[model samples]
Target: MPANPTLYAYLRGEILPYDQAFLHVSDLSIQRGYGIFDFLKVENGQPLFMEHYLDRFYHSAQLMELAIPLERSALQEAVFHLIDKNNLPLSGIKMILTGGYSLDGYQPVEPNLMIVQQPVTMPTQEQLQKGFEIITHEYVRDIPAAKTINYSVGIKLLSQIKAAGADDVLYHQGCVVSEFPRANFFIVKQDDTVVTAAQDVLKGITRKNVLEIAGRTFKAEEGTITLQDIDQAKEAFLTSTTKRVMPVVKMDGYAIGDGTPGPVTLALLEELLKLEKHSAQR
Candidate 1:
């Protein structure tokens, strides 16, 4: 067992105190917001879907032309090492690929990779049982396909979203819903068909797994979901690494269906919990 009282962070080739990890101001991630990251959940000190997360991480890096310094095996070793060092029971591991510090601040230097683990705080059971609310925005992200660290548009609209009595923002192009700020959005129709955006979304890990799980039992449609669809949805939900599967009660002042967690959403949530429960063993 590791005995460090402080948390450990991997920065490039060094593993040090989490607080001691630093990035230069000239780093493209800081100066130009050029970086990508992927998050995986840790349960019983075991990181779940690490390979899937890494595959997406590397894909995101490639899409951004960001070079990751360490190989996948080495990065996996580092993650487990960090987990052992911290000795946390349940947590989240976030892997970041930064465009390294440049002297001129405009050019991309060699990329830097960092791995850090933090305690996981899942959404409340009440929120899951009763469901949550969200507001919609008419905006699209730059490089929507890549999981870059640029969430300025999402973060900037936080206040407005909160003031509207909503938890997060669902982005859309015209009448079509794309995704939430940090989660993938989905809708279950009266006919029991699942619908979400296809082209302009992050294609989240949890989203992918949920599709696989739900597709086994329901019609999983990876296509456009319109605002009218939201209004007519029998149930709605969001998926993320930390959030898991959560029911969406309302969106943009419209009460989704009966404004409560529907049967399909609950069933999917149960399936998601099962997936999480066995992820460590796998």
Candidate 2:
């Protein structure tokens, strides 16, 4: 990880030294677990899909009723300023809005906003070539539509998932596939149809773009994906800001398709990388 003592962060309305950006223990986000945050990548000192992420951040805050103390324009300025201040060639930027410190450590108060810039490494090409397996847990997020700062159920299963030789958890209710802990899930049918769950999903930015790419290159559908459907899938993959497009080789203990990255999976990855390159250049 890249680290510099000179890195700056935005706290509330003030730009401060990174180490000085601290919150009171009694803040609602700390005491009552009330907060909303969004993270996206920066390439060549430019943030990608920042406007889309910021829109989701505001909507998440609205869903939790945790008011953000800054307007969109002000928040954007703060984020850009921090990026310039940090100046990491590649990084992941997180924008957070917390329900303010409460006198009783319960009720909401004026919110605290923060922009944290951190150096990050993209997933390795070797990891993608070998692909990764994911385990399914019978769980669903509290609010599937909102990107709120709550990951209790997902993170709690970290040990269980890792022990199973998996990279992540795909949450489902009964036999119907919903989504992964932090990413969107998709599977290709025997007939090469790309299908992903539309409802009960976080609607990730990477997911949105992949669906568009699939529509142009292959047949794409958004609907219910059951375990039975997965069993019959020719390919499977997960999408997220960090992972981009990741092939899923196995589910539970069963090998998906031929236990290798399928043609459709590779094609989408290639196109997505091209898109990423274009974004980086611009």
Candidate 3:
């Protein structure tokens, strides 16, 4: 891997190198995980569907009672600045909005803005073709709809999931399947219905697009999915800004359908890719 290049971080209106973008040690976002953020895909040099991501980010920040000091357009420009500064071909951009510095440790201030641009690389074709196996965990997220930083349980379970020979973990409370560590989950039925959780999970951008397109071709529903639902699924996959539409052939030592990517999953992938390609060109 190329040595991680130095990337720029924008704080308030100031641009600083990564190491210089420091937060107060007592910031509530660090002490209590009181922060909200968003991620989006950057192709060539532009962030794809950035406005949608920013809208959601602002919503999450507002829900958490944090104030963004910059306009959405200003934030988008900051991302472009980092892209050019780092000379990145493909990248992932993130903006962290937190209840800024507090000497009292609990007092709130205007949100601190931290923007980062990092190199983007995908799993090799060999890795994708082999498919990823996932482990199911019993952890649950608090205020699941908000993209906050209090992700202790999800972060803690990753190693155990990887040790179990899986690329990720699907957290389910008893029969209720919530979501993956950082992606949304989906399952296909023999009848060609695509099902995934409606709430208590991040409403992924790719997930939204897949549902919109699937409306024309196959049955798609956003409702509660359980471990039982996934175990019994005819096909399964996960979606995210990075993963896009990925096939999950197994979970927790059990084969998903016939241990292969299913027809519905492939069809949605093809359709989603075409839409994204067209959107990029526009």
Candidate 4:
């Protein structure tokens, strides 16, 4: 047998070396790009909001019609085991369910489950305060509720985003704002109401927490936000597992408010950090 590897992955009912985790080429995920995934952050040896992530993961599997072989409890146990084995304190865990090997290479079979751990670094104060810019695109995701592995459109626009001097792309449909590629978008109205899209967007875990935190101090609502609404907005920001609360200073070459990280955005970030610390303790 080979020697023990440094990193490990939970794949197909086994904890194996990260490099050894493999899926057959005949898998529908490879042939038809059929799969779903959910990612969550781990801090100080604890998985943050694991229950919520698991809930979404299972929901995505159900939507994709991929049956996860492991029970919820068993999956949770495997996740913990993988984390303990890898021993990465500040990291992110990715849970993936892929359409398994198919006889015709186009049909779904027994799904393959994979859990991987990778190191993660939080944004520095300078990076957070500087904020970022986003270019707008007039497109919406198919099956927006499920967290699938389909990112072809977003990935294809990388060149356009870089050419436009932006960090990411904000998706919209018929002038109605939706979400970013991997993040949820929120805009603060002139009246201090924080609004995010209510329909046709993935309900992100970070987005959920931000809405809850913002509601305590502001009028937070899940409703339609349009390009026109953004034009009259006071400030804007995004939330994701990696980007907890990142201010959006510019959109399509115009400044959002004063073109800097707004006070409300900064305050929410602080509260989110505190909440995360408390969560780690629990």
Candidate 5:
């Protein structure tokens, strides 16, 4: 494995090394995976859609009935502090809030907020131009709307996904396609109709922006989608904070359309890249 560069973490009002921050083992998050987290990107010290990510984090914490120990303003300031402390030019930020220490298992107290930064590399130009393939598996996300720490199902399928000679996996329950392991899925048709799974998956910030940008050019519907529907579409793609609008050339053992990144997928990706660039400038 490659050596991950050391970065700073903001815990409460103190700044510490990423690996030194510690949490108790008796927290509900440790015993029952009762925690919420958010991922945001920092470009040239600017956090992209930071407020949106924080809003989602607040919502998720509320859903889990976990009270964040720090105020929103404080949290934002901490993130900026860490960014400056690390002297990071560009990086991905992950904020993890777990229910903090307790005397007994299954009990909760205040939440633990950890902000970490790491250098990242995006997919190659060839992978972006040609798109990537994925396999479909039978798995469902529990409380998929909340970005929780538990990822057992996704973890178990990692080997299967790799063995299929693909980039990732899309999960399906019966005929209804749920989502990818870490991204949302979308399908486009020859008639220019775009279909995607509704609120059952993560409300990805990037996914929302791409849909808003492409809504003028394509007809998008948010609803239940089937594996057969994916196979029938002219093109398919996955969206997330890290991958943005990633084209999906194949699903399961079947090729999407002609087994190539379709025109519509490429167009949306181009528009998304422009949006990303503009966002970074702000």
Candidate 6:
């Protein structure tokens, strides 16, 4: 007999067994795919940059017209309670707010909130040095500012991505480059200026940290980047909560600056790790 599962989740106002956390079929999140979510990392029992994550979460709820049932302080307390119950030292915390159950299944009602904690592994140095490849797709997300649950297009392109021998897809509009399905894109210029798309992208927490770290050693700015700009760039990378800083050595089957992680990417990754360590200690 296998040991019983011990994982737990926070649903509505109660902390319950993970498997018992459920939402009705009439929820707009299920019927209309209306919802928003935010994820943050926890290290050594400390949630990193929690306030920043909460700020984004509340902002997303407001944008989606979904009201969070709990106050900010109450939500924070619930998160901590969930963390303590799960007791996962190194993990990722996912906060999900969904359109609640509705009789008509077309209009917004009381929103459902759920939080889950799961173990996560950080990337190794070898993996970072080897980097990964990405294929380009000409599509953009709906409501790119809010962290909505509508990843239909990205999910539908999984086969295409794997068929092309790529790890992910980079979305673009004609020649204008935007971002990856789950990460924000960045490139290094010949003059060492770091640039990422300024519009039509979800501003990721890790992306913000990278910009701040890069600003100390190089010129970091957000603006429009096109395929032509990437073609002439010296290096490329992507950032997200899970990926941290991942080098993009190839795009659309072409080598990006020797097809390996560059100095700028590696330096930024080191500084990011340092920042995560310091932030976790706080």
lDDT of 5 at 71: 90
Clashes per prediction?
Answer: 0, 0, 0, 0, 0, 0
Q: How much RMSD separates candidate 4 from the native structure?
A: 2.3
- Model 3 Cα lDDT, one tens digit per residue, 63-88: 88888888777877777787778767
Off by over 4 Å in 5: 1-6, 280-282
Show the colliding residue pairs in model 1: none
lDDT of 3 at 148: 87
What digit string (tens of lDDT, one per residue) describes model 2 on residues 191-240?
88999998789989899889989999789989999999999999999999
lDDT of 4 by residue, 117-225 (tens): 8888888889798998999998889889999999999999999999998999999999999999899999999989999999899999999999999999999999999
How would you encode candidate 1's per-residue C-alpha lDDT over 1-282 as one tens digit per residue? 332437899998999988888887888899898899999989888788787898999999999998889888888888888988988888989999888987788788899889988887888888787788899899989998889999999999989987998888999898988998799998999999987679699999899988988898999989989999899889999999989889999887889999998899889888988887777723
lDDT of 5 by residue, 21-53 (tens): 666677667787878889898888888888889
Candidate 3 Cα outliers beyond 4 Å, as residue runs: 1-6
Clashes of 1: 0
Q: What local distance difference test score does each model get? A: 0.88, 0.87, 0.82, 0.91, 0.81, 0.91
Q: Which candidate, 3 or 4, has the higher TM-score?
A: 4
Q: Model 3: which residue pairs collide? A: none
Clashes of 2: 0
The 10 consecutive residues of candidate 3 with the worst lDDT sum are: 1-10
Q: For candidate 6, lDDT tens digit of each residue in 126-243?
A: 8787898999999989999999999999999999999999989999999998988889999999999999899899999999999999999999999999999998999999999989
Q: TM-score of the candidate numbered 6?
A: 0.97
| TM-scores of the models, in the order given | 0.96, 0.96, 0.93, 0.97, 0.94, 0.97
